[model samples]
Target: MVISNKSNRRHFIKKAALAVGSALLLGGSLLPASVMAELGEPEKEELKFGFIKLTDMAPLAIAYEKGYFEDEGLYVTLEAQANWKVLLDGVIDGQLDGAHMLAGQPLAATIGFGTKAHIVTPLSMDLNGNGITVSNEIWEKMKAHVPMGEDGKPVHPIKADYLKPVVEEYKKEGKPFNMGMVFPVSTHNYELRYWLAAGGIHPGYYAPAKGDITGQIDADALLSVTPPPQMPATLEAGTIYGYCVGEPWNQQAVFKGIGVPVITDYEIWKDNPEKVFGMTKEFTETYPNTTVRVVKAMLRAAKWLDENDNANRMEAVKILSKSQYVGADADVIANSMTGTFEYEKGDKREVPDFNVFFRYFATYPYYSDAVWYLSQMRRWGQIAEPKSDDWYMETAKSVYRPDIYQKAAEALIEEGTLSADEFPDFATETGFRAPQSEFIDEVTFDGTKPNEYLEKFSIGLKGEEVIK
Candidate 1:
């Protein structure tokens, strides 16, 4: 397998030689001829970026490996950080020019939630690349509650209600039902909480005001932070019963036969936005051309990942398997990256939309996506106090920069590398997706009316509410 993959890598590199040569030749050139003829050179050409070892960080890897960054006259060094907080702090303190970040990070930071700093994202990284997995014992207990399919396999999109009985049993036995999420303000935290709440379980709350930031107030299930790569081992060691995390950790569990991934975030909320490419707002303002160029390069990489209906994903899996990147076995990463996900050991199913890269306008950083993350932060008491709908709107506008994204997209379109139709219609785009009603609870979300949407949730703090 190693010999075969090395041969394939050499072939892949040979095939890309022409493109790489063109990029190197074009590196010194300022703006692409057609679209941004007037735009000046990138102020900073040598950059060091950071990313966690996750598959959704593929755009950064692809851009760097495929010469997209060099094509834009940018010399970039990509480094893997210790954890999310360290990554965020690196960007904050100028140690990193940018990073592949959780979608909630920029929003939470801009709103002064955790480490307060004005961070912003020009492009969303990817969508729906996460899943929830349970320890074997927990799955065994919940398996009876899950309806079986005609093939005798457990039904999918398995609602958390099945887990509810197990949690109750644990509670009845005077035990604390513990779970893990990637971070406090992560999509994992909110999605896990959303799934649990939808199933009539209170995953708990945060009271930053009272310095009780553990987020265990009024809880049935206690959730704590466990870094993504450590999740499978953590669960196997009985540190956490189940965890919500990005791939290929979930797939790792299935591969090791230690846990079963019960549901994917795709089932929790279809095509939900996941990670983003984030930098300090100061960095963008100081180097506008560099920012637009960074977006342009990543836009090209994203298109490549999703082009021809993901025919290139197998190649991507090989790139991601390198020791410097995800560092997981190629097969484990391929389990979901190649468009199928494994729940139980042998229960693999085709889920083509499992890891959306460029399709569905996933690269565009919509304000609506920002709003959803903020709503989750607010719903879980991270906000500490209630604010008006206008605040949500204003805050989202501050963090998500579609204007920068548009400049990049238009540049790509003008270069004939991408088509105008491939993007949202810039002339009429409003930066907001229409009302969506595909949640586990069938709750509708309209980005423009965040407070009203929050009011509809049976759980979570709504208007005028604060954790006491």
Candidate 2:
């Protein structure tokens, strides 16, 4: 049904209601009796969701296109917003029911970093969909320092150590080394900072307590915000030397012959969590069943995205290439979505997990993921003051609602829509992964110990250290 047309939408709804009535009479409702009893009919049937035009917003697109939202009795309208701030504001002011948000948006909002609101996420959208790219000139200069393999190509997982000399060269010439990230609290920002610091370059600090949120307090590289879609153009115009963003923007750079992606977030931190499906706490409380239903539909969409070794990825890429979706060239969107990522012009490599939507329990909203973002916030001075380990745990619990996710997963399993093996065993699940140690710098991260995690970083705030 073409939901974009008002007449067709009304017809679709009428047909859907009749279909449900017929199923009930035939003792074959879409959901099993037990599942239906557990999750009542949705309190609200219509919803409008917001997202940025990045490839990671695939789950929402897939849900709407594949009719998963309709399966849960939701008529969802997916709108692409201008930028992250506008998207967040839409949700805050009721202009949007929910949105595809940076993993840190809800946490940052709840903690009163930029805006104060109680935002929550029941589902993580996708994982490992971002890369750091540099302008062609920067890559040309840095290539001299990068180690080449026997194949005469640069070695895999190109470390920022190779870029340090280039940054130093710019410093020697008294030129400001500037880079771009999608937002202050975005994974792109933290990932870029992590790469730079690992190479002995300071990405700088944020001192909100001293009213300095520039995040370039004591820096070697000045990182600023540039929306994802504008990344390639901004680079071509030489407005920024490099940027960390999600596809197909990174791939767009390669296609435009303007830049080269040095490393993907997958290389920085394997299977790192990315975007989340965010809604205000008030919306969830006022319409609990609607919230759970929304999750159920997205779970189905996420599963479809990663099932059969990503067999559906090509179709997803086509949908994303639509002007209303990611709005990039099909080949460019397929470059990363199809399991291969292009670093340089002809240096494409297999990165099958580059844009994970469901495999590895990606949709589950783990508290550990929340803790990681919170730790980065504190590490970068977004939290302003030192927070206790218990405080990190409390904050993570408040924002990442695994409880809501569990309900949706269980309902899907009970209805035989998804199998039990596809999910983490809720019986033994603690909403935390085992201590993660896959970072590019070889630093181990134990989510339970946020302070210790911060202490391990050389270029970030730690303990009682404030930006004095």
Candidate 3:
């Protein structure tokens, strides 16, 4: 009889496997010599990973589809979580093995921001896959203030300064100028705030200590959380005038002609770190072999993504379009993935470095990147209290584990799967990048000194400052 019961089916399969094994032994056991000598077998072979429906989640999908995970002797199930919090909680609660998480999630968690947990990341996912987009109406109001080029197209990197007048006009009408970001601790929130504050617009603050997490105190424009996929619809409903989100949603807005993408995060801050591969610190420590193998698989996938000048991006787009993956249309995902980003409806431009995955040592989880995110949190009051430079360094080291990343890269190099030249030189590698000054406002940020970095911003909380 055919067994419809799952338990019975499993039992039958187990018995069948044992019988087959016994026969094989009776028939003079034949097994190939082992090849997994350098790196031991994964402590846990089956894993369930979670991700949101954004394009930057490509590393997980690519690793699964390209057989990189299996090549590492791991059976991974990639599930799409409802949102960021859900995805994070899944990892914390042991429902998920790991996830494609925000760069700030692990840091914020370890520092007791939203959900208190010891989350850590060994890999930085793709970089520069996010953009700031505005509703067509907002664009129309702001376009008049934007300078035009010889082709009559609005000049590139259309600064939020142009939108300041539109915000003021809304203020004059007693209407709240509302905008959306993925999460409060998200890079999107900080990027949106940075662009707005750079334009002399107050994007507001988070008074978490005072129980005012609305992030709208003393605000010129009110910013709130909206899931990435809902951003375009929220704009259509007039709930928000603009949003900063990761791809294909921003590109989706351009394709649907409902909104205009104003600036990519690449323009806001060149090669900025975006998503990351996150797991609970306990999980990594308990399953060290599995964690290393997981990072190794993802590292190979990331390299494949940016390989040969993104020659594999089109195939990557197809995989991401599958219903089990990003589930966006191939064209919408391709709009940004293929090295060109459509800003205004017809203003498609070449932004080859728009979605970097492996080039420029982008895969390394630099403590400096973590420090930059923490500095923004303090600048905007998410941190609530002043912290010393050493505190910032310690917090960054706790969350962004480059030691784990280095181990994975070394294993990949030893296996001949990747070359040592493709990765950062582990011998002399420092976790910090040289001070970066390419912000929209040209503000130089020294990750080694976060409090001093906060003092550079005029619109944010500096040293010893707390929300009143």
CA lDDT, every model vs. true structure: 0.91, 0.91, 0.89
Considering only N, C-alpha and C atoms within 3 Å, which residue pairs clash in candidate 2?
none
Query: Residue 365 lDDT in model 1?
Result: 91
lDDT of 2 by residue, 1-468 (tens): 112322246667887889889988998886778888989999998788999998998989998888788777787878889999999999999999999999999999999999999999999998999999999999999999999999999997899999999999999999999999999999999999999999999999998878888899989999999988899899999889999999999999999899999999998999999999999999999999999999999999999999999999999999989998988899999999999999999999999999999989999999999999999888888888888999999999999998999999999888889999999999999999999999999999998888998899778889998778
Cα displacement (angstroms), candidate 1, residue 91, comes to 0.1
* TM-score of each candidate structure, all chains considered together: 0.94, 0.97, 0.93
Which candidate would rank higher by lDDT, 2 or 3? 2
Ranking by lDDT: 2, 1, 3
Cα lDDT of model 1 by residue, 1-468, tens digit: 111122234454564576657777978332355555645679998788899999999999899888788777677788898899999999999999999999999999988888999999999989999999999999999998999989999987899999999999999999999999999989899999999999999989999999988999999999999999999999999989999999999999999999999999999999999999999999999999999999999999999999999999999999999978899999999999999999998999999999999999999899899999988888999988888888888999999999999988888887778999899999999999999999988999999999999999888999999988
How does candidate 2 score on lDDT? 0.91
lDDT of candidate model 3 versus the reference: 0.89
Per TM-score, the best of the predicted structures is: 2
TM-score of 1: 0.94
lDDT of 3 by residue, 26-99 (tens): 98322222324545778998788999999999998888777677666677788898999999999999999999
lDDT for position 36 in model 3: 48
Instruction: Give the winner by lDDT.
Output: 2
